[model samples]
Target chain A: MKNNKTDFIQGNIACVEGAIVAGCKFFAGYPITPASEIAEHMSERMFQVNGTFIQTEDELSSIAAVVGSSWAGAKAMTATSGPGISLMQENIGLAIATETPLVIVDVQRGGPSTGSPSISLQGDTIQVKYGSQGEYQVISIAPSSPQEMFDYTIWAFNIAEKFRTPVFVMADVMVGHMREQVEYPEDYNELEIFDRKILDDPDSTEGRFLSTEVAPMPIFGNGFKANVTGSTHDEFGWRNVSDPKVMDNFIKKLTNKILNNKSEIIRTEKEYMEDAEVVLLSYGSVSRAALETVHTAREKEIKVGSYRLVTVWPFPEKEISKMSENVEKIIVLENNLGQIYPYVRSAVDGKAEVELLSPSVLGEFFEPNYILNKIKEAK
Target chain B: MLKDIEHPLQKYIRPGTNYTTCPGCGNGILAQSTLRAIKNLELDFDNIVFVSGIGCAGWIPSPSFNTDVLHVTHGRAIAYATGVKLTNPKLKVVVFSGDGDLSAIGGNHFIHAARRNIDLTVICVNNRIYGMTSGQAAPTTPKNSKTTTTPYGNMENTFDLSDLAKSAGATFVARWTTYHARQLTKSIAKAIDKKGFSFIEAISQCPVHYGKVIGMRNDAPSMMKEFKSKSIHINKIDSLSNESSDDKIIVGELVNENEKAELTDLMQSLRTEVGTDG
Candidate 1:
């Protein structure tokens, strides 16, 4: 099973396979719709790999446990949907402030609150970015297919470890449950894996996690007298709420660490955009329909192309602007009621007229026929 | 002369570490008792991790311990400590928390951790009120006590935390007040050495907050004298059925059992059964 083989498995299972290959040693998750399979597979898989898995009492404990495990020097992760994300946001902020590297897979179901559990929607794109309070940034990767689910999870872990921050895989029910071919690699050890920098010198005060270039984690149980906290702190990890200077540096260093490295972090896909009039922009499962519409429009001699966002956050602002420059209009296609349209529109910055095209019925993925008709109307 | 003489346990404290507690706050007392127990147990600082949630008690080990410490979010210390202990079972993880933190917001994590019988020691400083945010009534606030929130006297009975730990399947349960300093240190040592879930409810005083609300003199001696007077030893169980003993603090070890398997060892046995033993 470690060698190369093709298996038709659900998108959620692909995530389990991906995490295991990425050196994830601990998983703590509560069962939720569409995301339960990830936890189910991890429960069995972790033992085989000599890892730890726990079905925690709730989402809060699941995320808290993941953070704890990560600090104790294990690659850790958890899976949940919209409601679970809501519960886990507090500890998510803790993970952010303490600079703990962990992965969270959000298999988004429709929701303002526990909306369709069995259905799929891209409702949590901005939620993943802003749900955790405070002035900090995150890396989120959206996967459009089961194969991408397997591949992007590894990328998510690598990005999380490299930056020493929480990374999210913005999965949805469609990609989570839909069975497709996933390729297990020939040698799991051959995959690119990134680990967080550990403090080589235990006596140095410099590895206290305040650098703009990131700092090595003074992980627990290794004799480093590390002070881990969610409060505003100086380089020593001691709470320093009164100092104006400490607050300024903490916010800027944390935010800029990701912003400075956005180039290496962001990934986008462009197709047939060299000569185009209209472009369909989307991410995750809705992109499947958008790509189909582009192919269908090409047969009819319509100069329409498609742009997809692989890395949903760090926004791909420049790429979106570039895509919009050569096109007449850019239609932001998504499953929900334009959750990502504002970001896409702002990125376009009026280079072209931007419009939002959602599924005819929410929770149902966009239909290519519906999109093509919209392209015909817009043109 | 007292300041010139270095404390024997000063090596375990971070240099220049200040207790920062108020004159009458018993947090310092419990803090010393915990450290004293660890020092006597001869555990290396490198092998122990202390997790404390948000409260006055949460400040016990954070920024003070020469050992690794996590001053985590309110109500989540037990959950986070679970991750640390289960991930590396060799590390002795201790959660130093307050009644308001462990019994209110983190109550679920406490119960479940005890239920799972994980190999961790938890020291709960039950100050009977929310001292950090001034004096609000807590789940452990004494019945009919006046608190900041309970202006008309508390309408609710307090949670018997030691009894709750016993019922929730903790393998070791002990209760003491700051007045019982020697016994508290001894119990902490015993709890640390215990295999499964070990909980120590250190009933302490908040002289500035809970003390004033209870109509006592605003001083540590006042509270200590009251603790010495009102507490009944666990050996006096026959008095528990009497109405007069209802309000008495039962101070001593309540439960110590070794029948169930500790979680880390259980996990190891699971690996053995799965044929993935390493």
Candidate 2:
């Protein structure tokens, strides 16, 4: 039975297919509204691909299991909303400190604390990057449509393995529940895959944490005598809290691994920015509204362009800064009050006027006219 | 070449690793018993992984054992080990943690893992107090016991871990004191052989913190004597008087049934049923 390559699917369903296609074999999650569909879909599909799906007791165990599965040589992931992500912060820090590769899909809902379960909001943008304590670099991707939800999820897993860090696919309720057409590849092997580097000689794992770049992961029961801990340690994965220099060198390597390679980690999409005077900056589901605003404003000779942030973390400052130089004003659009607006303002560095068109209330999207009004006002 | 005659299982100990445990701590004995169990089962060293949580007991596995070890965050070893087991069911996963790590902070994970009947062995070293952070009352701390955190004496009740495990659906549940090294080792071996969630709670001695406050002698031998006096075997539970049974530390295997399906096995069967096995 030959089926059409393109199928009308929900964004969360597309995410599940992307994960399975990307070789994700372990999923542990606690169901939450808007994000529960991802878990439901994974539960139905995971075992079909010989994968494991566990509905953990809570978000903490979900992420902890994902981290464990990753170290056990399985690509793992979990999905949740804002409040769930908040509960997972500690283990997320553990994953980062231990350099475990896994994926976390934060289907963005509203709130500081369970504010709105079914509403669409980008409030978790900053939380995803800075939610966990301590200084560290993270990779977070935003998907605007169902197609990007599928494609970026696979990219998130590849980058998670490539850098040996937890990657976040920041999807919002709008995209998560939105039904749209998605094109599935005939074969998953056609996509780029990045597996963690493993040491051939297990004996060489001694002093393992010393390497600054991505360290070769050693699986348990692999005769590596691998010792993995979340505490600050030397290269051998032993706790070394006494020495200041050990902590310094260890933390530096962790942050620099992504920050120094921002060129490869950061991505953005731009439309009609070549000669626009006013540019709308957005990400996640808000980008869809920005795109519509761009089309509507351009029809009115408003000279408005849109720059969608494909990668939210590591800030994409370079691209935004360069765009800031060409535009007379930059209007940041988000579903939250103004989380990413400050970053855009800082990136612009007074090169152009920065305005925020954030719909602070839950369960609402900024209509094209609202953003067009902002663009005209900025002009 | 004159080589000192060491214990037969000394080779299983990681080379050049020194004990981080305090003197008179029973964690070393538990570690040795774990290794002895693995040795008796003739399990390949390459096929075993030791997971530990944050505490004195958590250090029992990692730098000391030659096997692969993961020293995860406080109270999360079981959850982490679940991932390891489900990802590769061939691996023999064992978790070593303390009362505070397992029952106090990680109580939710402990019960849920048991309820799911995951295939893994969890060896909980119950010392009645949190030894790693000085003396602090733990979930297994006996009522009215004194510790740094409970200078006025603890008012809370303690958990009977084996009962908790049994009620939570563990297929194999047992409790033993550090003095019952032989029995503890045999129980561990049996747990390793069990196909579902297995829990062994070792009533380890924390003489430095817990014993000193409780008026017991602050030495390993004295603690062992106390355990011998207070312990009762499970087979004799019906013979003991109610008053004596209340104070006795029940020892021996309490549950060894495996009727319920294991988590990993169920997942694999589901995959096979769906024809998704690769």
Candidate 3:
């Protein structure tokens, strides 16, 4: 155990600290159980750092305010639980449509709406991706522990800034409120920060007019006349609501921008996919249990491997597809009712069998023996 | 799609079109007042941002002004305006919303923005009744007036526009009926010139909707006549007492001349104080 001052922190606490270290200067969020601590800790730390903390009227405004702050050129973020995350969906779509880089922390609790606040669940994995209207790719990170949470949050901001897209730190109640020792980076200034690429052409007045596939976003105070809109738009930021070509181009460019950069955003951990017939897939804090089970099963001479998803959004479909070729069956363990299972099952396309283990159905988590039994059943 | 981003307002209003209010209807006069203010301030034509919510008043900025205008979601003009302003604080942002749009559905954002003292001008066209939705009883609708939503006498008390602004933390709050054309123009100019959040509530007329519902003709002349007769202007604090006639409606600068630290100035000051800590 680390000392009290330099001791292990909860995943949520680490998320807050990570954002602070990442130079996030603005935070706007509403207080919801299981996620309120993020806001509370942020409020105090932000004040100390002379950063901005706005307790918005609701989750919608919370996200909207962060968007506003981000446009103001501050690295900004917001945190919420299930219902609050639902309210933020429209603004999330707005963020995507506007190409404003912002990070959102969704501390999952059991819920369709205000389900169990105290319990831990990973039900929002699919919701975080598909809850918003429209077709778009998203970047989400699942942290398995406090240290992982701290590290991934920094990664989330970097990805958001680099790609100019919203990033998600999908965590749950147990990881959020839990306390554990966390090591701080010795020199935070040495950490790399990614800022959006600004237009540099001096002679071309047409440079600011983005007719290209991916429109480059201009900083607000910069002299460029950038029009940010939610409506389907042309490159100049004008509302091209009537044009299908504009809509198609807008969607195509946005999709391609993230898709083409898959090598940069895709992250996963492959334990024993080399020679395993049974593979257990998990994310967030639940991956710890899965890893433990995988090691225990290995002791009994069972060829079981565990694959942990660090970035859940751009889905990691390629890695899963590759693993599906050799693995006879894939068992997915999460804290929710099979949210990511469909993606795993679809990724393999019946090339390998898929099974789901949800805490809502079974319990908080599967014990090592229980996971081994599930793996045995897969055989 | 328009090739050039002309203010929808300038493109929509035709020379001989009577689609707008009567010549004297407060909407036309308020529209003129807005243009006059914008011109007097000599705001950069391309950088001026006009955002309007849903209402007849909301349409005022769409077709007539040759500037950057956003026809945003209903009661969400402020939300969009905040985005525009924060995106480029140098860009002049003005929100054009109706009484119902600002006071009812957009009430939360209204008070919250004012409380923060964000630097922008919010021109609220308070016609007493909801004109676009056809004379529904609005938040600013006078009690006991007949409208589509209130066939019987209205039971709910109406909101006082100036009072609401004062309490909401606006550095400058003023009210003038469309009948007070010069006064309305001057108030708008001052509001625009103010460094902090400023609000100018223009009481206009809804002849086709609220007027007809309460036995007035849909004609523009009669509506203008009603507005002029009922309009009252307050030049001083005691102007209310001098013109305390129930038959006449109150107008003029209700609250004027106060300044607070604008949001950006405060942030910059904090940045300076914190220096490297920031």
The DockQ leader among the candidates is 1
Measured against the true chain A, the candidates' chain A TM-scores are 0.98, 0.96, 0.94
TM-score of chain B of each: 0.96, 0.96, 0.84
Per-model TM against the reference: 0.98, 0.97, 0.85
| Model 2 C-alpha lDDT per residue in residues A92-198, reported as the tens digit of each score | 99999888999999998878787888878888888888888888988999999899888898899999988889999999899999999999888655668888887
Candidate 2, DockQ score (0 to 1): 0.69
Candidate 1, residues A1-379, lDDT tens digits: the string is: 3555888989999999899888898999999998999999989888777889899999999999999999999999999999999999999999989999999999999888968898898888888899888888989999988999999999999999999999999999999999999988777668898988998777886857877788989989777888888889877787889998999988988889899999999988888888989999888988888889999999999998888888888788887887778889999988888877898888889889999988889988788989999999987
Docking class of 1: medium
lDDT string, candidate 2, B1-278, tens digits = 34877878888888877878787999988988998999999999879888888999988988788878888888999989988999999999999989999999999999999999999999999998898998888988888887888888889988988999999999999899999999999999999989999999999998888878777747878888989999988898899889878889989999999579998988888898984435
Give fnat, all candidates.
0.79, 0.83, 0.12
Candidate 3: residue B176 lDDT (0-100): 74
Worst 10 residues of 2 chain A by lDDT: A205-214
Q: What is the C-alpha lDDT profile of model 3 across A318-347, one tens digit per residue?
A: 889988999888889877778889899889
**TM-score preference between candidates 1 and 3, better one:** 1
**Candidate 2 CAPRI grade:** medium
Report lDDT (Cα) of residue B182, candidate 2: 95
Quote the positional error of residue A324 for candidate 3 in Å.
0.9
The candidates, ranked best first by TM-score, are 1, 2, 3
